[model samples]
Target: MAILPEPVTLSLICILVMMCVKILMDQTKKNKYHFPPGPRPLPLIGNMHILDIKRQDYTFMELAKTYGTFFTFHFGRAKAVVLIGYEANQEALVKANYDFGDRAPMPIADDFQKNHGVIFSNGETWKITRRFTLSILRDLGMGKRPIEERIINELQYLNALIGSHNGKPFNEKVFYNATPNITFSILFGRRFDYDNPNYKKMIGIIDDVVKLTGQPEAKYYNVFPIIKYFFKTPGLVVKRVNELNEVLHEMFKEAQEAKTEDSFRTYSEAFLQKQEREKATETTEKIFTEKNLLASTFDLMVGGTETTSSTLKWAILLMMKYPDVQKKVHDEIENVIGLERPPKWEDHKVLPYCLAVMHEVQRFGNILQYLPHSTPTDVSFRGYTIPKGTIVVPLFSSVLYDETKWEDPRGFNPNHFLDANGKFLKRDEFFAFSKGRRVCAGETLARMELFMFFTGMLQKFSFTPPPGVKKEDLDLTADPFFIMRPKRYYVIATPTI
Candidate 1:
């Protein structure tokens, strides 16, 4: 009698109807969507169990061997398409372009950037911020004149910082500060003294927060939206991000006070002027607010700092690990610029070996290993239909280490960028900065800084492992995280002078 009551009868009927609808939708998807080939996914957890959680790049490599170049997989219930090898990536992300131009949603990246910057934003918002950013950066000499002078000037401070050690062993702390200060000065219009309490705290917080992102535990939150909402795993990331924001906010406040209406001193003032202009136009919903400015500023700061610094850090570690390579690079630089003065951005013309070494560092460093893109709409890529919003990882590892692309994909070989006559040869397969509309906006600036700072250090000193540590035993293995950074170790920077 209770079961037959009106409420109980209605509940039973509703449940049955909903179940039929779900079954029908599942069947429809099966019949309609022609997803790429891959191993079958299980319910709920999906393909996460099969993945090598710690090193995703390595996992992706192994998966390519099984599923071939383009394969569909899942992180929990969400579908992901992995584009492996040079051709597969170039076709989908490069030639087809805008179809796969959207940024794949990642909770951790959203939280880190607060979803207001160019890296994670889409549509008109992203377009406005990107265009504004490029304009301001160029005006401030980002890839050009005054910027190169700023970098070359910064190298003096960096070289002095290294020389302070008096050939004693030092960790990455000094290198970290030296690299970021160049971008930091450009973004805020002033250089931070390396020992400034606020500066130390900011770098330390970012370094730690970056470590948390690419870890297996935190990456789940990025892939599966459910985990991010239900769990407390992002608390540390949130806290550190807040700390970084506070620091950036203070910088903006300082910049605002210093700026005249007509004179834009830094990235902050240019952005503020845009916000004012947009407000005057009655387009108050524009992305030119302080939040977007800071997000874009933070994007430049974090990205500019991390990639160039990490690559150089890896360069030091690689040179130390392979001393013979170091000697040749040292000898080449000696031949070109000599030890009396430092290396400039323009020195690349003569420093072929040194230039090749930098390229190889980027290639082998593979700092941003797993580059994620997304399909904005249904994209028929290479005879496979990828549904809208599917995550596409253009495996940078595959491009950086493709057997067909590199003569010896496994080793750290600067000769990879060199011809038989020892001329610098640029390889198209080197997708360290990625490709397409999403290619690194700060690329020109990064390249200039990497060449200058790297040669700057090498010109003044030869980096080698600490005494009693054999070059054979020195660990060049990267400390796996959001970026591939050299593991913490001391190196003796013996001055070439």
Candidate 2:
């Protein structure tokens, strides 16, 4: 064998020495800290070897039973706190919001975000962008009439599309893409035809990104980027994110070129106005820049599109499973508003059962079951210390499924939102829209859209499994994805009216 160069041999020896020392120091620190109770971690790999990446929540669920409400889990070399139960989560997320008020750094998410926008950003970036976004939802109309009316109007198109389905089984695509088409019109001041290929492609890309980024392989890539060459996911994800951002930028440019003075036709215009105002200030660290706007707009569009669609899927699924509830909703709509007119947002108060069904859908759906929240500063909570930048996952599923909080947390029961008198009741455990300062900014828009779409569907067609299929045969568990999306099933939308 040939002898290696002296410099190369020396460098390799030095690197090996450093890595050994680093591992030893990490082991020492792990021993020194008063970390929450959990399983012992192996050397170098930490607890990754024991973690069930495909079903992390299940693993967490089992370990929590052993370790109690508060515990720690290691993701490769990194460790994070898992907060279970309503009190543990509420105290950390709401009562001590600022202490746990940052977004965790994921290599994939960071690559897509580049530290821009509200959803994936923290500190001043999040604060300013969120303020700007909330302003659009609060002040004036998204365009023309009020946001609720806009949603109600768009319901006609979805209603027509499903009507065309002729009661056959249709995938979530129509239901999923409907909200995005409406929001895109609101954002870009234009609408895509139902068969518009570009719009379809964009929506499909976002769907893939959402699901792929949440997979166990994603964690592996984050922990080991060198594995990227061996696997295709990282590269493909990056390409798709670029494609999405490029499309958003183009749409924004088109909107900006067509100047309008009539009170902000689209969200893009409103965001541009903010960007211009901030740009004229000429100060560094001005959060309202083009990249931020693009990221924010993209974030809003993706979020606005995906969430309600997922919730509505669960809604229809539940309705099909419980024909009694579906009939009750139809009866409630006919009694309260009648088939002459669609369900309006104001009619929500009187249609208590309808509203209850909607709430139960969201609460039980709990699509955002797993989330990563970060501590921007060293957080000392409940006699434990969580260092700055530590990733904390406040289990929304825990709150939604807490037996102490819900009468029947596991079942698909709408009575959870109804009282003895059959009136709608609100529960504090309903954190489906999330809670605290970091709650979903699009809560208003999402709620209106869901209420209208859900009621509208039930009003036009009664949902059920295909002929000869029983409710018990339907699967309740979601497809393994970022969102708790229900598995593929056939639904017949028989004309109820």
Candidate 3:
């Protein structure tokens, strides 16, 4: 009977051998990978339990204090190495530049077929997109007359919107929509009319999506990838992103029809021409298509809109909290360029306090709190070995609020950017736009937008808290997002005129 069953016995023995091999492989993997020290983790769940979840700020800062500048944390199956403090950030971003240049592959990125736009793409694709984006921006008259002209147009529209209130207490959010829309126009070569219903609805969707992004619920989705199917929040993000894509696609379709092959005029027009030329090449695989053009355009629209607008929103909130500083800034702007005209990008040279105030807003508000980077290969920095594909976050909060870097790290002080004579002075550590190869491509445009739009608003109106409100009582606290935006609060825009 045993001799007759030899084949079945052999099969059973092979199954046991395979199970043993898998166990040995798993154990070897655990032993071979030496991760950086981190807080105690639960089996399978890892350190997610220890994480503050909602407060990435508090969690990261506290982890740095306990585990040193560089520590590791597990996001489900994936491991993330956090780099805290200025020096750690420098090591990852500068010293190990190329090594820590890759972005972690996520489900969203994968769903996009890993064909992420310039901001998230790695290696050659990223290089090509970034280089071309810079060149195109310059060609489209970034840092030139076109930029100033567009800004002035937008400002005139914004001023009209604000002035419609007849010096009454109207919330600035409606008018503030112009700031982002202007940048969107420059990037996509299309502008939204003031009070456009579709535009307002799009903004509302984006607001909700952005709110859900930095929340615990979003973080929960990130941790448990399998559970994403059951979640509504992540689905909402995807839906909003798709809606944004549809909007951009329609804009692109319009640009394509309006495109004259003889004239490569706007960003979209030039990009479409380039796409056509490259598609004619035998190696069509490498050519960036109209899709890439639209995606890149979308990147600029989202990045520029969210960041620049949020910073300015926070600026008004800060001014409300410190009315004395606000008055000084108002007085300085008035003294330099009177209320007859709104502030222009050119007026930045004379408006020292206004310039300083903008810088202070960027520093103090610190939107885009920490710019996350990732290691592409093994790198040794100051004797510590950084393994391949480790997340290298530049603690932007640390750089923005460095105690050694700033005299008043906690305060909203425009003097932070001023000297004894009150001239605007730039700081090397002010990495608001970040630094090196991966620094923000749209920084020049964003800077111009912020200065022009902010000064434009302040020149026309002195923003004050509502009646019976104390400056101290003004809630300057942020709405707690991936971008630090002030909580919704109405202010009286007393006309400076």
* Candidate No. with top TM-score: 1
Query: Where in model 2 is the C-alpha error above 4 Å?
Result: 1-33, 140-145, 223-226, 260-263
Point out where model 3 deviates above 4 Å. Answer: 1-34, 108-113, 284-287
lDDT of candidate 3 over 306-392, digit per residue (tens):
888888888888887887888887788878888777677788888888899999999888887665677788766655666788766
Q: For residues 275-347, could you state the per-residue lDDT of candidate 1 as single tens digits?
A: 7778889664778877787678777877888878888888888888888888998888888778877677778
Q: Write model 2 residue lDDT over 221-298, tens digit each, in one string.
A: 776666777877777788887888777888888878875655677778887876677778868988877878777877
The Cα error of candidate 1 at residue 308, in Å, is 1.1
lDDT head-to-head 1 vs 3, winner = 1
lDDT of 1 at 112: 57
Cα displacement (angstroms), candidate 2, residue 221, comes to: 2.7
Better candidate by TM-score, 1 or 3: 1
| Global lDDT scores for all candidate models | 0.83, 0.80, 0.75
lDDT of 3: 0.75
